[model samples]
Target: MTDILDAAVERAGLPVHWSWRIEVRPRRRTLGLDVLPDGSIVIAVPRQTTPEDVTGVLRERRLWLAKAVRRREALAAEHPAKELVNGEGFTYLGRHYRLLLVDEQTAPVRLRGGWLRLRGDAGAADIVDWYRVRGRHWLIEKVRSWAGRVGVEPPEVLVRDLSTRWGLRTKDRSLAFHWASMQLSPDLLDLVVVHELIHLLVPRHDDEFRQRLLVALPEAVVLESKLHDEGRRVWMGAVRAAL
Candidate 1:
């Protein structure tokens, strides 16, 4: 079913040696483990799978998963949590701006006096809306620019809140980007743009795909390493206090 059946699984006396939580999915052909960006693991299993099989798989991969989990935890600790309050640092286009709340402002969000100004007592919604709007606009422009360089038609940008991916390219040639991409510096963000645009030419990440990417962005490898480092700071565990 979904992640909700975890209690039943535990009650059934399955092994819980795995440090992270698991989601058992029946009616699926594959038994897979996804390490989410929020530092959680989702284990998907087929209907015919046994608790013994799942436990075996987990045990076999225990060391690798443990290392992965530690990395995720370190990243989370690096970014921590961001609270929307006066003088709190918020990023926009590689620069940090203090969030200044003003009561008399008409707009819910905007840039005023170099601060990410909010009208009144704002929560997650207002901040998310503002980031989404900016991310969408910026990514659309990047898609257009990078597509032309890649010799492909520009794809329509779809901004989304994604936990498992930074960017995705669909069969329809449209590009989907995580909204937090806006927090990245322009150079780092360009790497994501170039990556998705190249996917338009080569769907799979095979040799030819990498060759083409290098041709367009010669420093792809270095840029990728930097992106991973900077991205950790951009990815706070959760925005809302409740989350």
Candidate 2:
């Protein structure tokens, strides 16, 4: 039987108090609510489970489920839609950059006078590519500056778009920064930098590695939370506009 059918039988018109979206897949398993990495809540039930059973479980875990959903909704609200246009501003490395439209340039994006000027013929793709290049240069500079203070220099830095991750570091001391990360706040971007640089010294995220990261960035946890809440929407919007 379908999970919905079962839930209906068990619930039998249970009073509506807590509400949640339920999903039943044809998996050979029982029911569970999974906390997705993107912060969405998923109540996964077997195809045979009825709505009543599902509702019962939901009622049992109402507080847990509600808290998770509320968090996601709040984060979604924080990443409200943005109107990308001339005079609109963005930040980089703790500085503000106003957007300007230019009609003559072949390249789609350029930075000047604390402004990120885009060619009038450009679209989101051009902007993304442009920002990626700029992000690499900016990140590299930041990394070099911070690394010098700690007496550690990475061998190389790579920049590209990556979904589901912000950055990566290899044993060879090469670093990869997500191009999509350009849309993130400077604080989070710097956290990524510190993360990869720390990897050069400690390859694993053990307690010692975490301690080292904290020494470099005391607000890493806060920045990471903000990134988790707003990063995807920011990048997704830009990518969609560019397309």
Candidate 3:
């Protein structure tokens, strides 16, 4: 199957700048193309899909696939990593706070005197936990406010590592946010909050959804662009041994 798809993509004459793979999804009814966060392409198709069909679909979506891959590549290049050391900077709600290693602390991490205080023994995981705890509390209130503006009840909000996504509205009608998003500015954070809240009303990103989102966030276009640019700089748990 892999050889056949590779040959098909070659015959399709698509640009070779991006990496791609084929996935046979047993339950998938139609061909789907996805550009992963790291700029890899995934071509998902039903089990019996032929190389010819895959080639045709790829050709039809060639322009879109190129654009998506370029965007992912740009983001991958801009993504930032962190070092777990004193004087290292961490962002919370768009504010940069220097990490201060302390000999003793009540918790593994805490914000005190405008510094992100970390216990000398704590590792990167502890810092992530700190963000989760802080983000959950902040998002709960944020979700409530956005929900009210969208004329819907606030759903249960959770904060954790959401991988490539910044936010998700689950089937249970609850909202889950990536803890890294706590690094976003308050305005960008509000955009994310209101985006999920609006999803509670509109399930898909269609025209109606865009109209409603614009009503809720007048500066959605500008803020979304900024979010994409700034979000790449947020620390996503990568840490160096020392700087």
Candidate 4:
């Protein structure tokens, strides 16, 4: 199956530079193309689908695939990695703070005196825990405000590593946000909160959803574009090895 898909993609004249793979889905009914955050491409197909069909879909969406891949590549290039050293920068609620190693502290990490103070023995996990703790506290209030405006009951909010997603609305109506989102500015973070709240009333990103979102956030389009640009620079827990 893999060889067949590879042959099909090659025959379709798609760019060879792309890192791509094929996945057979037993329950899928149609072909799906996914460009992941790290610039890898996934071609999902039903078990009964032919290589010819795969080639046709690839050919049809060639331009779109190229654009998506390029965007992912650009974002990946800009993704930030931090070193756990004195004077190293970190962001919270869009404000930049320098990391300061402290000999002794009550906690593993704390943001005080405009500095992200980390215990000398601590590492990236401590910083991540700080983000999660602070993000959860901040998001809870923002979620309540947005939920009230959207006229829906506020769901339980959690701040954790969401991988490729900034926010998620689960089937149980719970909302979870990426801890990295705490690095975004307050306005942008509000956009994330409002986005999930709107999803509670409208499940899909259709015309109705857009209308509702615009009504709730007049600057939704601009903020979304900014989020895309700024989100790329957020540190997703990658750390430089100590020299």
Candidate 5:
């Protein structure tokens, strides 16, 4: 359906640069715009939807799409592409560490003297994998700490590179967290863990849920607002680059 979407974009005269992919799925009930981590768009619709229908929504949301593009471009400018070379910086635990490529290091990644002393042969993917490995352990520990305080047993915690969420709680009470959570400050990370652990008792973001969340962690709203403003600036594109 690329031709259909392309034709619609031309007809609408939208100045979008990314190639928007039109996907007709079997179970989709409504239309939505998805900005991929790699700065692409996906228009997901129901199986039998027409290009005309998609075009109408696109035109209607022209302003929103424009804002999305501006936001993406701003982020791109703030966090330009990394060459993964020596002296390049990466974030860990909300602190910046400059990379120092070494020849005889055994570990793929390590921190020394305010520097991320990485093996000269290792690449960006290797650093991301290292973060993922360390993130799993940190998230598990945080989950256990918060769950204990909330009178809930810790569920199965796993870390993966998520595109748009910091953490998710499944129906079975198991939890999954984005590896990018490791880059957030400790307070923000605590908020994320507390937010998800509260999901065990309250499934929705209702008033009761908010109250309970505050009872567990008082600074939820304030910190979450900051996180919204600070946003998930997963800049180096490690999440998508490794994928």
Candidate 6:
């Protein structure tokens, strides 16, 4: 596999300025390639496909591969630095809250007196850490409220900074949400949280699922559309934060 990758790189004559790696997956039925967030490539091929064939396919897709790799690298470069100091903002329930740095003797983030408060001078990573902790707390409370109203309760709930997708549901009734949803409005955020939790009972998106969701959220379609258009910006902003 290493020899095949080396040969492909040699044949393609790609630039060496950027870092790259390749993974060979024999389970693949055809030549396939994927670009990782760190600008590396993972190439897969069926057991029957020859190295020469893999190289040719990669060569044909070189331009696309290069563009994908560059985009991933660019997003990584845009990730934001964290701080509770002035000029930093936090996204809570789909709204942007400018971090109003205040002089406090504690080292914790709080939403007090109608402001998202981070009570220490911390870097971007710290701010994210605060969110990972406090954010889940907020999410759990909100999800419980919505679940009660919807008459559905997931067996478990999880929250994290997911790189893709708003939320997911597991077969065992575990519901997960992308922490970035905090950037959205409370109503929209609740809608998403409830939607994922309901999937614990109804695992697939079918008519019954839509019906239940509508009963749970009368404005589900409207909010879903808004998410499709504007909600993507939140993820994009998070990617830019990588810079």
Q: Highest lDDT among the candidates is held by which one?
A: 4
- Kindly list the per-residue Cα lDDT of model 2 for residues 115-141, writing each as its tens digit: 788887776677667767888888888
Candidate 1 residue pairs in backbone clash: none
| Tens digit per residue, CA lDDT, model 4, 62-174 | 99999999998886678866889899999999999999999999999999999999999899988999999989999999999888888899899988999989999987999
| TM-score of each model, in listed order | 0.68, 0.57, 0.70, 0.70, 0.68, 0.61
Give the clash count for each candidate: 0, 16, 0, 0, 0, 19
Order of quality (lDDT): 4, 3, 5, 1, 6, 2
Candidate 6 regions exceeding 4 Å error are 1-62, 73-85, 100-105, 108-121, 235-243
Provide the lowest-lDDT 10-residue window in model 1.
Answer: 1-10
lDDT of 1 by residue, 121-227 (tens): 66657776777887899888888888888899888898877765789986687889887778888988899999988988788999999999999999999999998
How high is the CA lDDT of each candidate model?
0.76, 0.69, 0.89, 0.91, 0.79, 0.70
Q: lDDT by residue for model 5 over 118-172, one digit each (tens)?
A: 8878877787778888989888888888999977889999888776788998778
| Rank order (by TM-score, best first) | 4, 3, 5, 1, 6, 2
Q: 88, model 5: CA deviation in Å?
A: 1.8
Cα error, residue 134 of model 5, in Å, equals 0.7
Q: Between the candidate structures 1 and 3, which one is better when assessed by TM-score?
A: 3
Question: Which digits, one per residue and each the tens of the lDDT, describe model 6 over residues 29-79?
Answer: 777788877677777666676667867887788899889988987765554
Give me the overall lDDT of model 6. 0.70
Model 1 TM-score on a 0 to 1 scale: 0.68
Residue pair clashes in candidate 3: none
* lDDT value, residue 236 of candidate 1: 33
What's model 2's lDDT at 164? 61
Cα shift from native, residue 26, model 5 (Å): 31
- For residue 196, give model 5's deviation from the true position in Å: 0.4
